[model samples]
Target: MQGEEQWFSRTPGVEARQKIELDMVNSLLTSVAFASDPSRQLALEIIAEQFEQPATIRTHPTPRAQLIEIVRTYARNPDGLRVLVDVVASFDPQSFGTVRLRQLFDEWQAAPSFTDDDWSAFRSALGDVVLPQLTELFHLATRNRRHRPPAHCKTAWHYFVHLTDLNAGADSVPPYMIFLERVAPLLPSSTGQELRMRNHRLASELGLITAVNEIHLHERESLPPQHHTAYLVIQLESDGIDPERYTLSHWYQWDADGWHPERGEDRTVSILEIENEVERLVFDMETNWVEAVETVTLEFILPWELINAPVDWWRKESHSSRPTPLTMDYPVVVRSLERLRTHRWHRAWHVRWQRLNTDPTSVLPYWSKPAGKNYHTLLETDLKSDLRYACLVLSEPPLPDSSGRTEIETALRAGLPVIIWHRRDCGSPDFREAVQQMLAGETLAQLPILARKLRGEALRLDLADRESHIGRHLTMLWDDPERQPEVSRSYGTPEEGIR
Candidate 1:
């Protein structure tokens, strides 16, 4: 081994490097009697090097066992394993070797002690080398499986999703849609078909069919360039979206694992009730608007903050500014929405109402008393108005709806959209069903139950919503005759609504 290293000192290339490394590894492995020994660091390095080389040329079981043993023994040292993973990932491959490496890499990733530094290093190494190689490998692997070459090997949209997770928080909207719109004309027919298929699958899984058809992949690119065949798209957003706030990560984690829904019937019923109320309110408002010659827009409001605010503003004001920027200032948001909706011809508005559970007496007194009577009066007047839309953005632990069946029935009659932003914990049946389907994948079923146990826990933690509220609302708008004309007017025009 020493002689080989000395010979390599005079020359260095792929072959020489391999010879020297292999000899060194052999010598190290011979020195380690027990695989569990903490002193076997040199053995670990050798095993990692052997693993990275092409499987065809590399030594087999002996080296593999050493590698596995190192991980099994020093799994707690995230930094050490991370370094090994990086070295392994850096190796050039002849086939789908990265997939095998990733499987092992994920094992180390699952360690409880894996720190942020470890994750950062893993991501850096993946992006720098592994991703580019994987892209090329996937093209080769999937080439025959696909009838024709994809307009582009890179599925821009799917790649966008991965990029979003890697860069911004994990749950932000993948830039796939945005990229598709920009590059659609540049894609090939085969690529378009594949993109459509994937979108259809995602839409079906997420129950988002009503929002919009998945973007046609070929709409932009006629012949995608070969050099751009890289499969992974890396995106990092500073202010685009928050994973925790958006409830995306929770749903993804649930889908990746396996978990059943808890509150199916109750969730469905609550949604139905909320929808009914919105419809009734809209109908009454529509009648009033038609009769009075006015236009109206409905605004849903959650009032947990105001209801909990201290009577002495000085004491409460300081603490108020400390909450998350994403935390909705219910009243401010409602007013802003109302202003946005204000226009000529017809104007009807409603607030999807919410109340806090602070001392009811204190909160109720202010809402009911003469000094603060305007708040109550305004709320009552708006509730009675002829509205074009009525929506309730309900939280998980919903407060009792005092409006009863009359409100729901009225909203149903009015033909308005009722939007509920329920927490995953409320155990909505739809959520459970979606989760079950996600877990039904053959691979997920093979995981240990304990590993999969946290599946639905994301929803339980109010991390994700099974139903897409924005999509549903858009669907409602698209279906409405009154809104259809407005949509058509805006369709190809520059005045498109916010995406």
Candidate 2:
């Protein structure tokens, strides 16, 4: 296998070669009604051409001997042997050539021999067929008759690295994890954990990081081997009237490129959709097989969006199929809390402020909470959707609860400011902050008597007439410079004292 590079570079003699049309050969094989002895002979000869490089088929007394001679000659070159094995496999699964190839792998796996070149040519010989056979090779490795580390054996060493590389950073689920799980007990502890971590990281990215409430993956019927399909029944967290919930079946196909949805078989669901709409149809169907499922959150990312990617769908797009960016609602900003009690206090303020500021702009601010929190009621809401505001109108000391206290602390750590309108139950701080109004010659804020009188008169007015009342109050607060103080005072009288 290693030295074939020298022989393949040289051309061989082609003197006795006869030109043949592959289409005509195909027609001869398919014309069953017109089958003849001569056509059968031609088929054998044509089969010989695929391997016979010197264009000379050795004349044997028996057809069996002639076929054996061809295989004997082809075995000298690894490339030819690989292709010859495939050709023989197509004609018959139980052919001698296929059996012998399997035997060679068995011997190699039983006790492998190490050489130079890292078996590069032999790996090339295996080609794409190596991928599908990975499962079989992994099983072969578990039957380690030798008392040595896996790195010493050719099959174990190569397959170990091969499996890790294939699973690492792969967006689509790789079959390597399945292989690893089967041989976990056989593998050294460190190697097994490393393999598990590589696979787990990939699984975590696809919003498959959730607790599996229940799952059912049952195969109804065997389809074509090429189809490689399966049916999965998953019971994700669902908020509904009925206990019986059903999610769409998922069919995933693994290729050289990462995991791709098999079009109609794979319902194109996005991570954003899963975060918000966990109970919706488009969710992580792979949860049935993928390990370590966690509560879905908008912050949960997909594998393709992991570090150093060309584009991060987790941040920018809904899913691979749908590139429409997930637009988050405005943030609900809260202030930092110095003490633990501040969380509860801010939460109380938040509930109250949100109620008063029912307008869209203030209620839904520039930043908001994550997908699953105390505030997130829309478990099935779009990841882009947000929670409404709540109010807490308390007259005294124990402002907010333990959870609200934690929320305030988190907001502060994230560098967000929470507005605290803490007016004492005695209404003292209401004027305490108005000291600046006094310093600037706007002194009357401390006058509760005048403040109450003005507020009562303003409240008595109709909503439409409040503006005129405000204008009158402002005129009374500070005397007009154009008029005498006495005249301004006379024009505005509040309970015979202030207005």
Candidate 3:
């Protein structure tokens, strides 16, 4: 296995190649499914074409000898060898295990040879936030790995700078890039929002060295991966539960250009048919608008009485197949119909929204004390005082007349934009843990996606337990003040829906 060293030592230009690079190339060549000598020659030919210089492969009696001849040729031009090394670094992980290939590629590409300008741009973006406890953030992000930061690094920035000069053995990406990805979720939304664009530019400039060779370097941040999105806004109004008004008040679509409104229709339905009516509106959107948009998010604007409705679980029927939950396909979030009707709480909403945007970590779900004697009074005071408490996670179902209902209304009045709760008895620790798992290092906007994932997981369990799982019961009221339906009709009569 170590025989390559002897050949490499005698060969000029090969001295610069790392042992891991040689090993990787050898492994990639040997692992490829080659039936015969002609196939091997063809593979070598294909690899050779990637280089600028034209070369001919020598005819060898044995395939092993042929591999050595190919490398010998590559050794003559170190730049060509770099190209070969890159190909080897990014060989198909299907033939090799992903973990092993990733590790091998990282170890092989550990030369963090970026220029001063690149470091300057990265450092500037990171300057706003205090060097986020580098060792701790690293340990939290890379807990599975056995590696530790060198003892000499005084700060996270120092460690990242140090990484650029030294080749740490397990380095797929620059330590700074990884640091950015990890910290992106933790940083206040205002911080590092521009880093993605900067990073994309840098990644483009890096070209093949960073993008092609390092496949997993750019993890999908919340920015830049913009999709053509459509918002289906459903406003529901009920009068004594007899006849409910359902209106497709707004169909807002956003693309690279910006947002444009589409006309919607209104309908009247009995209390029993409200869910069915909502489903039909969604079906119409899927049929009429889904083909036009890249992604769709369903927004159900409901009064306080119906706020706890599981809109995500509602399904639309198709003649061809069984119905699937709306959440299974699109992100569904509940919005406050009452909140949209008035500008009274607009100032509070703006204050909290700004706080949420400025420091998301500070505005994480604030749990209300559900059982104290003066819990409601205390909770109201806390919410009113702290504009930073943008999200509220209740301990019980917010059904009409319940304490949970009052808590929710208070939170809404206090201008909290997000409220999550189990739709039923939520005192169980499992619900809290489930919320924790969904929110761990995730942006607030990602809750619907994460909650859908939990629901999907629940579907895999036994039917009896599935209903009991936190996934089925979790309901979130995520009202973004920035993105709202332009209510044409005032919250006047039940007969006249909010158009």
Residue-by-residue lDDT tens digits, candidate 3, 428-480: 79998888777675466577678778878776788799888988878888888
TM-score of each: 0.20, 0.21, 0.51
Clashing pairs in 3: none
Identify the runs in model 2 with alpha carbons over 4 angstroms from their true place. 1-44, 48-55, 61-68, 94-113, 116-499
User: Can you write out model 1's per-residue Cα lDDT over 1-499, one digit (the tens) per residue?
Assistant: 4543432222223333334234333432433222344534443455445433412222235654454334333333435444544443344222234333333343333322223443333233232231333333222222211212222123332233232222111222223332323332334556444444444454456554333243343233232223211010001111124221210000000111122111101111232233333334334333432422111222222122111111111111233554221111111111111112223212222121111112212111001111242543444354345332343222232223422222222332333233222232323555444334433444321212211233223223432551342211110110111221111111233222112
User: Which candidate achieves the best lDDT against the true structure?
Assistant: 3
Ranking of all candidate structures by their lDDT, best first: 3, 2, 1
List the RMSD of every prediction in angstroms.
24.0, 27.6, 20.7
Clash totals, every prediction: 33, 27, 0
Candidate 2: deviation at residue 412, Å?
52
RMSD from true fold, candidate 2: 27.6
